[model samples]
Target: MSDVVTCLWGRAGWDRAAQGLLGAGRRLADELGGKLRTIVLGPADEALVTAAQAVADSVVIAEDETLAEYNPESYLAALTAACQKFAPRAVLLGNDAYGQELAPRLAHRLGGSAAGDAVELSVADGQLRVTRGVYGGKATAVIALMKSPGVIWVRARAMAPADAGAAGEVERVRLGIAADPRVKAIARHVEAKEGVRLEDAQLIVSGGRGLGGPEPFQKLQALATAMGAQMAASRAACDAGWVPASWQVGQTGKKVAPQLYLAIAISGASQHVMGIADSKVICAINRDPDAPIFKHCAFGLVEDYEKVVGPLAEKLSRHS
Candidate 1:
């Protein structure tokens, strides 16, 4: 039985489970009186390894050309080998795209079980107890996994990443080098996109169909850029061509848990609400009091957003 919790680290920034993984890492470090080893998977490895050294007790470096763009096969293989060699009691995975894909495969390889989107996890009755949200984020349920070694994917924004000031000097080691003849990163390219990516943004300012047309969506965009925030569009706004699909936020688009989510002229549909449910503050603006958005919004302003927006924007500018 292992008493350590190991984390899967990323190079191009950790996915959704960044916070919870760090939280789990710190907790396990304190509980076990041992260190949390953060293992990073990368094609270009050094950059992120340097970043993780600030928090982790030790860093495991896995490198491969096939892993340049996150090919699943090599990643799972390397992680499984590391887990077996280290024999950590628990493994924490980031619940983002890569984490969701890698954790299950690693568990399968290690002959253990895996759980996804876990919000709360604890050791109870000699078993791992996990909490996960379900039914459209309306309710959460507890689950117990009776496995010797626990494997889990903690969802994005579930727990904040640990804040350890200043990074330690990173130690570079080539432990598990992958040999995959399947894929190669010949070139890397970024498609031209808008100002901020919603998933990584600290603040998000969004608009919806209630804004009327494409003409008014600019106001939200301007406000977002001015405040150094990401501009998000509801599914309805994208469907109407008011904004691009990449900026759309909802169950179908993207799940963002920014610190602050401001819904402008938005009625707050369930599909839209579910995406940003992890936001610390939800301020929704809509003229319709019964828009259903009010039910979930922490701050609801019942006024024509056109009138409320200019004053709000003006007031915000004053502080900046």
Candidate 2:
């Protein structure tokens, strides 16, 4: 069998993460002189098939009623079947919850090596190399995989999306794996937060421990609304009960790469900075001039957030 790069497309529709995987897979396939194959495990949809075809050499749809929702057991079985059938040189998956759980397990099942949270990937001297953040984003490390069929989980927003190419043929594959009886997904619970999703937002306004309490988040929220941005918080703020855990953006929280990130009252700890390392620009407003965040930010205002935030929101509102 020839070298092949296989990517798993999740049910998030052909979202940015999927696009990144496809782009990275395409480059790897080109370097290996192989083909790029994408597999979708849910019920088939024309839109998904078309989008997958735009970037992949071939699309495989594993259609099964049990896969209508994510069931770890059935998903694993189907993935195993795909690996056996395709005999790929490498397998790429998004570095999200599902991919984080499946990459290692699938690698173990296939007797292959796995890499997680890869921000960059390339092939050199016939070996697969993956680059990822280390030491909580204070540094980065590159790992070389010697084994064939390397499984990799790619970080979101790290790779650019692949341009739409010629549509490829679609193939349907069915795996006989049945859903486990012990585990059932009766319903999904989504957060009721309004405004743009933090990960998807182009601009973000974040607060930290300087806010002191939850009451100040409303001010940040108002600023965010005025600027058409999303509101987020540092881990300290979330831990201090000033905001919901979902709003936290740090090593222990969501990784973001927005075009602009405005951090207020944040100390800019390595853990917090790691999450926004990929942001195009960073601006900090803190009373402490020595705040670590100031060193990493593109712009800094050493002033109390309370004195500036309300007036800044008003100004933005007027401009809007």
Candidate 3:
């Protein structure tokens, strides 16, 4: 059996996360000395097929009207059948909601081992091991999978996407699965966001509770605009309704790995730091010298955000 990596296409077909997923799969498959077979559940658009082919040995499409929206039961069934057919030595999925729900159950169904939120994978002495954040991202734990067909949900931005190459073979499958009537989806509401999605942004400007109120976010937004970056928030700001829930970034919120992450008045809780651990460079603007965020950032300024943001925004605006 080869290594099987499965992902559902984004609403517009292939999205940014697709490349990283396939990249991880490619690495694991190469380490295992097996072919990488990626299972994508969406329309087999030419662009998707071409991109996946560049990284995977084979690309399998499972497209049907029943598979349009994400229903846990239907997706589980589809993945179960696909894994069984492929008889994969390992299975990889994203660490988002879908993977968190399905990974353990899929392992149970397949009689394999499962791990979640993995950031690293390797093979040593013919055994597969994974490294993941522990204790709310303050520590790391390495786990070894002793069973065949290890099911793993990898964190986003954990690996650089594999470079494109010659196209590979493509296949199509049908599961004839249907959504359960008991769990019909009424409607879905997506939060409207301007500029780049936080996950894809190369730069980010984030705020925390110390900002005092929602109005401060406007200043951060202005800084973000000047810097050509996305805006995000800590959980405290979101829970207080100072920022939209979608803007929250923490262990329980969105994980981001921008080239530069600027924290404004953030205290740097471990949960919050965990979300930005992958960031290339972290800078903080907090008045408190003992703020935990200072420990994690490469650059730190002990000044009130109000004193720094306005001037910084003005300077950046001039350059822009």
Best by lDDT: 3
For candidate 3, write residues 217-245 as lDDT tens digits.
99999999999999999999999999989
lDDT of 3 at 282: 96
Model 1 segments more than 4 A misplaced: 3-10, 14-20, 32-34, 43-47, 163-189, 193-196, 318-320
**Stretch of 10 with least lDDT, candidate 3:** 6-15
Task: Please provide, for model 2 over 76-178, each residue's C-alpha lDDT reduced to its tens digit, 9 standing for 90 to 100.
Answer: 8888888987899899988777888888988888888899888888988878899998876768999998776799988856788888885877988677778
- Per-model TM-score versus the true fold: 0.83, 0.93, 0.95
TM-score-superior candidate, 2 or 3: 3
**Candidate 2 stretches greater than 4 Å from native:** 1-6
Estimate, for each residue in 58-81, the C-alpha lDDT of model 1 and write its tens digit. Answer: 766665554445666777777777
Candidate 1 lDDT at 162 equals 71
Worst 10 residues of 1 by lDDT: 165-174
Query: Alpha carbon lDDT of residue 223, candidate 1?
Result: 76
